[model samples]
Target: MAPEAEPRQPPVDPRLWRYAAASRSFFLVIALLSLAQTAAIVGFAFFTTRAIVDAIAGDDLTGTLAALTGVVVARALLSLVRERVAARASARVESQLRGAVLDGIARLGPGWTATRSTSHLALVAGRGLDALEPYVGRYLPQLVQTVIATPLLIAAMWQADAISGLTVLLTLPLIPIFMILIGLATRSVQRRQWETLSRLATRFSETVQGLSTLTVFGRQRRAADAIERVTDDYRRETMTVLRVSFLSGFALEFLASISVAIVAVAVGFRLIDGSLTLSVGLFVLLLAPEAFLPIRQVGVQFHASSEGVAATRDVFAVLDAAAAASAPPAQAAAPAQGADHRLRLEGVRVRDLPPVDLEARSGEIVLVEGPSGAGKSSLLQALLGFASATGRIEFDGADAASRPPSTWLAWAGQRPGLASGTIAANISLGDDDMPAETIQQALALVGLADVDPYRMLGVQGAGLSGGQAQRVAVARALARHLRGHAPVLALDEPSAALDAAAEQHLWQSLRTVADAGALILLVSHRESARTIADRVVRLNSAEVTA
Candidate 1:
C-alpha cells in the first residue's frame, strides 16, 4: 500500500531565525557587551605598551602604575559582564529550542515517532542541543562583534601608521583562508561523527530495552558483544573527529602566528631605520594579532560548533517532515453537552487499507476481534484519531474531526506508559485536581482497591505485577469517566496480561460500564470477551467480517 502524502512542513531555517528574533533584545545586549569587552582588551593592550615604553624612557612610575591598575579593573568587570550575558542568552535559546522540538514531536504523533529511536531523540534533545550552547552564547555574538569591530580597528591602525596597517591588512585574509580550507576538510568528518553517534545511541537503547529478553534466551553475552562492536565503532569515529579538529586548530594557529611574526618583523625593521616611533611600533605590533584574533577565534569556535550544526540539521529534518495540522473544520459543530455521547466510524478507510465502518452507540459494548496481524490496532488508533482516515467519524452525529479527540474519548493501549511517581500520580497523569475519593472509586472498579494508589512506583511501573499494570491502566480509563462526560472507552487487548479470574472481573466491570450507557469497545481474542459484547466484528487479513 502506498503511504499517504505528508502535510507540508514549515521551513526550519526560518523557524530558527524566528527563535533568534524572539530573544532579539537579549542578543542585542550581548553583542553590545561583547564589543565593549573587545574594545577594553584593545585599549588595555595599547596603554600597557605605552606605559612600558614610557617607563623605559624614564617617565614617572607612579602615573603608569595607576593607569595600568584602572585598565586591569575595567577589563575584569567587562569580562564578568560578558560571561553573565552570554550565559543568559544561551539558556534562553536552549529553552526555546527544546520547546520547539517537543512541540514538533507532539504534532508528528506515533506514526512518525515509531520510526525513530528513543536514543536518537535523546541525543538530539540532550547532547545535540548542548552543542548549540557555545554557538549561541559565544560564537554568534563574537561573529557579530568581529564584523563590526575588525574594519574599525584596521582603520585605526592605518591612521596611526600606513605601513603597519597595510601589513596587518594583507595578512588578514590568510587567517580566514586557512580557516575556510580546513573547515571544508572537516565538514564531512563532523557529519560522519554525528551519524555514527546517533547509530551507536540507537543500538545501545535497543540493547537495554531488550536485555531481559536476551537474558531469557541465554543470548545476553551475544547482545553484549554487539554493543561492544557499536561502541568500538563510535570510539573510532570519535578519535577521527578529534584528529581532524586538532589539525584544523593547528592550521589556524600556524597562520595567525606567522601573520603576527611578519607584522613584528616589519615594525622592527622600520623602527631600526628610524621611520617608526617606539610607542606606535609597539601599538601596531599588538594590534596586528588583534586583527587576526577574531578570525582565528572563529576557526576554533567553528570546530566546537560543527557537531551542533550537524545535529541541528537532523533536528530540522524531524521538524520538517510531514505532520498533521490542527486546522479547524469550516463547518465545525459545538461539542455535545449531554450523556448521549455516541461515537461512530462510518465508511472510514485508512490509506492503502481495507474499509471498515463501525459504530459504538451509548450503552453498548462493541467487540473488535481479529486474527494476529489484522488491522485491529489500526482501527482502534483511527477511532482515537492517531492516524488520518477517509470518511466521517462522528460524536453524537457530528463530525468527530470537528473537535479534538481528547474531548470525549479515553484510549488504553496494550502497554500504557508509567512514570516514576506515586500510583495516584500515574492514574491522575497530571490532572491533580481529581478528588482522592474519586481516584479510590476508580481503582475499586478495576479491583485494585487493596493497593494504595499513593504508594510510590518506580520508573516504568517497577514493583507492579503484569495484572497490576493492566489494572492501573484500566483505572486511568475509569478516572477519565469521572470528567462528567460519558467518554467512549477504547481498549486494545485488555486481557493480554491478566489471569483468567482477573480477566473475568475486568470484563464484568466493562459490562457494567457499558450497561451504564458508556460506550465500550474492546479488542480481544478471548471467547469470554465475545459473550459480553453486543456486536462482534471479526477481522481477517485486513478484511472485516460482521
Candidate 2:
C-alpha cells in the first residue's frame, strides 16, 4: 500500500510571532534605527560627493573631508545598531520558540511525542529553530529597512537627479516580482528538504539505537545501507535548496547591477553635457544600490530561514494540539474523613489486560502477582492514565479522572528515568529548590543511605550499579510520598533488573513505605515480593483471586 500523504502546511505560522515578543518595542526600534540609518546613508553620499567635487574643482577640501569623515562614522554606528538589535531580537525569538516546543512536549505527554520520532523532535527543537536566526536577524530587518529607507533614499535621489530616480521607480517592482515567482518554487523545495531531513534523522536514530540487535542478527550492514541512502537523499535536497538560493541571489544582484549601470550611464552623459553637476551625479549613483539593497537581501535571507519556517509548522502543530487537549484544571478534592487513602478500580480493562475490580488502602502493600503476559504493565499504565480503558478509577471515592495524574500518585516505573546530575538533583529531577535533606532522607528510606547525596550519577545511572539505579527510582517515589503530596504509590516491576539479594532489599524498602501510611500497588511475581504484601491478588484469565 502507498503511504499516506502528510497534510499541507503554511509558508509560516503567524502564531509563532506570539512567542517572539518582537512586537511593539522591536518594530519601534527598527523604525527609529532605520530612520537614523537612512539619514546617515544620504548624508554620507552627499559628503563623499562634496569632497570629491571639491578636490576636482581645485578647491581646498579640508572642510569637505571632515564632513565626509563624520558622515562615515555616523553611518557605521547606525549600521552597527541595526545589526545588534536584529541579533538580539533573533536570539530572543529562538529562545522563546525552543522553550515553547519543550514545554508543549512535556504537557502533551509521551502519548504525543511517542508518535513523533525522538530524533525529528530533537532536530526541530535544536537545529531546526536555529534557521530563524537569519530570518529574524537579517531578513526581517532588511524588510523594514526597505519599507522605511528605500522611499527616503529614492526621494533623495529624485532631488539630485530626476531621470535616475524615474529609472529606479520603474525597475524597483521587477526585483520583488521575480522574487515572488522564484519564492514559490523555493518554498516547495524547502518543504521537501524538511521532510527529507526528518526521514534521515529518524533513520539514523533508529539505526543507532538498534545497532546491537542488528549486529546480533547480522543485518547491521542492511541498516547501515538504509541510513546511508536516507543521508544521501537529504544531501541532494539540501543541495537543491542551496542552488535555488544562489540562483535567486545572483538574479537579484544582476538586476540591481543593470539598474545601477543605467543610472550611472545617464548621469555620466549628462555630466559631460553640463546638464548635471558632478556632485549631484555622484550622490544619485551612490543612492541607487541602497534603493535595491533591501530586496536583494530579502532574496538571500528567505533561503536561510526557510528551514525554520518549515519547522515552525511542525512546532505549532504540536503546540496547537497540546493546547486543544490541554487538561482541564483539576478540581481540589477533600479527602474522606477517616480514610488514610483509598484506590478503587471499578471494571477497568486496558489494552489486552483482563478487567480489574480492586480496592486498595493506604498503610499497606497490595501486590498483584501473576505469570508474565498478563498485561501487568498495561494495567499499571491504565491506572496512571497513560493508557486508555473503559472503567472508572477512584481515589478516596472521587473519580480518578477528576484529578490530574500527577496529583494523586507517586510512581516508580519498570525502567525509571535518571539524569546525569548530583544525587539530590537527580532525585528532584533537576528541581534545585528541592532541599538536599529531602533527597538524603528519601535515599535513606529506600536503603540507599550509602549513596552520597552530593554524588553525581550519569544518565540512566551509568555511574551507578543496576541495583543502585533501582534504589534511586524507589527513592524518587519515596520523596514524593514523604512530602505528604501523593496518597497512592504505583511501582511496576521495580526490581526486575536487580538480583535476588537486591530484590529482597528493594521489597523491604517498599514494605517500609507501605507501613508508613502510603498505599502501595506493586506488580511482581517474586516470592520475596509477595511476603511483604498485606494482600496478594492474583490474575488468571478474567478472574481475580486473593
Tens digits of per-residue lDDT for model 1, 176-240 = 77766777666667777888889888888888899999999999998889878888887887788
Off by over 4 Å in 2: 1-33, 52-59, 77-111, 129-133, 158-170, 208-228, 257-282, 315-351, 354-369, 382-404, 414-475, 481-488, 493-546
- Residues 133-183, model 2: lDDT tens digits: 887788777777878988898899988878999999998988989988888
**What are the TM-scores, per candidate, against the unseen true structure?**
0.68, 0.71
As a whole number from 0 to 100, the lDDT of residue 308 in candidate 1 is 74
C-alpha lDDT score of every prediction, in listed order: 0.77, 0.80
Which number leads on TM-score?
Answer: 2
Question: How much lDDT does candidate 2 score?
Answer: 0.80
- Candidate 1 lands at a TM-score of 0.68
Model 1 lDDT at residue 172: 85
Least lDDT summed over 10 consecutive residues: which range in candidate 1? 6-15
What's each prediction's clash count?
A: 0, 0
